[model samples]
Target: MFTNDTPRQGLLGRFVAGLARTRQGLAGQIGRLFGANVPSAEDLEALEEALIAADFGPALAQQLMTPLHQRLSRRDLSNLDQVEAALKRGILDILSGVAPPPSTMDHQTRPQVLLFLGINGSGKTTTIGKLASRLITEGGRVVLAGADTFRAAAIEQLGLWGQRVGADVICHQAGADPSAVVFDAVQAACSRGASHLLIDTAGRLHTKRNLMEELKKIQRVVSRQMPDAPHERIMVLDATSGLNALVQARHFHEAVGLTGLILTKLDGTAKGGVVVAIADQLKLPITFVGLGEGVDDLQPFVPETFTDALFARS
Candidate 1:
């Protein structure tokens, strides 16, 4: 479990670096809009447009600006720093309101199941590999379950990650029943005394009905195999996809009740505000965020640094 233990100072630097694109754009907008003696209606409207353009979504963009609006109404913009501070505080509030409580189990329970869900190419497999590598480095035992039986390549890719990370990979022949793979994986994790079991589920979202049902089946199988398992149902999203990511989250959340979120490619998008939109709309905790291609780039989500990173100056 990341447990956001990457150290605050280090995490802040990583977040600032990962959010470079977003910080440049958002910070520039805030500075330019509020640089004047007092913010004009036009400036406020432009700020809203910038927030929406950053993929905060129209409603959240408006909702998040309430603090800034309050300052404007109260003629409290005398302290220029307060302008950006209010925006940061607003975003922080949205993120913090949905933050999940810290994991108390702390990998004490053997074979804690984690279900990875997303559409094809959402970096689900890669994220799993990175997570396994981290857990193993921290001296935790991990088992990778290639539950995506539809693709022979996915099974092979997960196997490679397992090998590289020195974790066990449980997979059936390509085109086998995914649920069967999940069941066997659970058994293997227990028998091997692994601390965590990461299951890579099918991502064929084009067939919504078939894919969702298969995922539900896998969830049911895992639940019966190990009680109170699938402890984490994490949906991986491409940050570049912005609001579209929310659509996928809604689908999976409604289908099997996602417990957390993982946004990938954070370093590649200027629209990181989508993070706030998803958290506010779904009310789910974001466990980890993929900042870059490196394994360590997949760091735990620290809300304070993440919010600060959005407006960090060069």
Candidate 2:
């Protein structure tokens, strides 16, 4: 029901524009450091500090600085071009190494299931809506499963997205058992021959063991309905949360084995380097990035484009 007629010529441009804050905060410092002369030890120290402040985290910041330091010692990085190129290469290496595997769903898999998990305020709901829009535009039938029954507003939000995208939403009343909702939604998706089923789970912190157990129960129900159901368990992360996002990811990955990540609010945060941190530390592929509030702003993760955007001159 959604149309893919919009021009995509500006996707890269939008990606670049959305990263303005991050570039200004992180890359701008590097640019200033490399502007005039070969960087001194003091300059390298400053660069390391900048990287850390950008939320690359201490370990990754050091990992990135190591190669540059080696190049500096060997007198290989003499100019701004070499300096910028080296930094860019380092970032790309970290990101590409953990790139997510190709989607498991094919034409034969009538309903490829994706389960979304994250703490509240991580944009899980909005990510689902944008993903549904993308799937529908690609000529795929979608069924939204509002499994976040703990919150009535969560169900209403998903229903609105379903209506807007012309996808069916399977939901029970507020406070309904989430596992039951998932079971019913799985059955409905199979019966309706939907190509994709997106399940939105309750947004609870990883510290909440009871809620995590509920998530496992929902997974069990879905698996019972179809052995290979819930093909992807994705955790949505807020770009602004910095290292805390990594903590959330670690817990969720342990709880349900997260297959990928979706990072939202990139346009609003200067800590976009957290993406690199997440990839390097968690080894979780970032599947998509929410650049802005628009439905079309959710773009697939491309390491080259992202690194370029991050380092591109303002």
Per-model TM against the reference: 0.94, 0.94
**Off by more than 4 A, model 2:** 1-9, 101-107, 205-207
Candidate 1 global lDDT: 0.86
lDDT of 1 by residue, 178-286 (tens): 9999999999999999999999988884679999899888989998988788888999999999999999899889989988899999999989989999989999888
Clashing pairs in model 2?
A: none
Model 1 has how many clashing residue pairs?
A: 0
Tell me the tens digit of each residue's lDDT in model 2 across 1-314: 22323344465687788888888887667667757677776777788888888899998888888888888898887776776788889999999987654452343666988899999889998999999988988888899999888778989999999999888999999989988889988999999999899999898634589878988998999999889877889999999998899998998899889888999999999989899999999887788889998888888777878888887765
- Span of ten consecutive residues with least summed lDDT in model 2: 1-10
lDDT of 1 at 65: 72
Clashes of each: 0, 0
Model 1 weakest 10-residue run by lDDT: 99-108
lDDT top scorer = 1
Question: Residue 90 CA error for candidate 2 (Å)?
Answer: 0.8
